[model samples]
Target: MDLRSRIEASYKRIAQEAYDKGYADSIKDIMDLRFGGMPDESLAALREIKDVAVMRSIQNAALSWDRDEVLTLIAQSRSA
Candidate 1:
């Protein structure tokens, strides 16, 4: 690929990795607060979320409540 195309591809990859890390961290926080370890379904659902802000919101929500409620909020956001 051309230099410009390579640069754009690299930027996209970096951004995607950062988002993935944020999502993983949020999932870990939720798991710790609820199940004390990662749960497959929750992890899968979190992977489906691409917005960092929404993932952060779910992490915040987990601080106050259980996993189901947090998942419900995420699902609602996805549908909207």
Candidate 2:
């Protein structure tokens, strides 16, 4: 690809990573409040998600659902 295209791709990747970290931290904060801490498996699953929109939706869901339901939503999203 051209230099400009390469730079744009790098910037996009950086932005996505930043967004993922922000959302993942939000999810962890909610989990900590609800469960006193989150399970390692759940944290792993959250990190595995690369889509920022999915991460945002999951973070919102985490506020209301129990841990298992949050996990189930992650599992279902992966299958889809």
Candidate 3:
């Protein structure tokens, strides 16, 4: 690829990573507040999700759902 294309790809990757981290952290924070902490399996499942849109949706759901429900959704997403 050309230098400009390479730079654009790199920037997009970095931006996506930032968004992932933010969404993951938000979910974790919600889990912590509701349940005191999150399960390791659930955290691992969250890490396995590479899609920013899925992560954002999970974060939004975590705000209201119980820990078990959130974990189940995360696991289902990973399997799908």
Candidate 4:
């Protein structure tokens, strides 16, 4: 690739990684407050999720759904 394209690709990758980390941290924060705390395994699994849509959906679900339901979603997301 050209230098410009290489730079753009690097920037995009960095941006996505930052977004994923920030989103994952926020998810943990919300879970801690809403559910008292999350299981360690689930928290680790959540960090492994690269899909922002799935992460956001889990975060949104945690805000309203019961702890059990949210846990189920997290587990499934990790598997996917």
Candidate 5:
């Protein structure tokens, strides 16, 4: 599949897993961490079903970042 299709499919799978694992709150927390308080679009997206594939895709996307850098960005964004 193409990238977009893969992402959608991943999203669906991740969403389901999130629901099953009772990690809905965790997803919200991640969004808050990344977006500095969560945009409406992100919130709306999180409200959609949690699927493992999507969650993995998101995790993969973030894998390139250094953990410290990610934390720094989150901190800087929050302070902005």
Candidate 6:
């Protein structure tokens, strides 16, 4: 699959698993399974988000939490 499709699929799978497990804190576990544990840079970047909506947008996307995307999203989220 293409990158976007892969991302969407992974997101769906993670969401389903989280729902089935009744786990609200499954984001880290999902990210680890989708992209191998979260990188330090990504974690640092995620720490910057202050808006719930923007943070949810990033969370809902299929995109992997690689360092650059993480930082970019966090920056955008803070601005939003």
> Who wins the lDDT comparison?
4
Give a tens-digit lDDT track for model 2, residues 1-80: 99999999999999988888788888888988887877787787787788767876787778876677777767776676
What would you estimate as the lDDT of candidate 5? 0.51
- Give TM per candidate: 0.62, 0.76, 0.83, 0.87, 0.38, 0.44
User: lDDT per prediction?
Assistant: 0.74, 0.80, 0.82, 0.86, 0.51, 0.57
Model 4's lDDT to the true fold?
0.86
Best-fitting candidate, scored by TM-score: 4
Model 4 agreement with the true structure over 1-80: per-residue lDDT tens digits: 99999999999999999999998899888888877889999989988999878887888888785678778888898777
Q: Write the per-residue lDDT of candidate 6 for residues 6-77, one digit (tens) a residue.
A: 999999989866553332134445566767766565555565544455556556652455534544665665
List the RMSD of every prediction in angstroms: 2.9, 2.0, 1.6, 1.3, 10.9, 13.1
lDDT of model 6 at residue 76? 65
Q: Write the per-residue lDDT of candidate 1 for residues 1-80, one digit (tens) a residue.
A: 99999999999999998877777676676677676765666666677777777877787778776667677866776676
Model 5, 1-80: lDDT tens digits are 99999999999988866574554355456545665554454445544534556544444433553344434443433344
Q: How many pairs of residues collide in each model?
A: 0, 0, 0, 0, 16, 0
Model 3 lDDT on a 0 to 1 scale: 0.82
Candidate 1's displacement at residue 56, Å, is: 1.9
State the lDDT of candidate 3 residue by residue for 3-75, as single tens digits: 9999999999999888787788888888888778888888888977888778777776777765667887798
* Cα-based lDDT at residue 62, candidate 2: 87
Which residue runs does candidate 4 get wrong by more than 4 Å? none
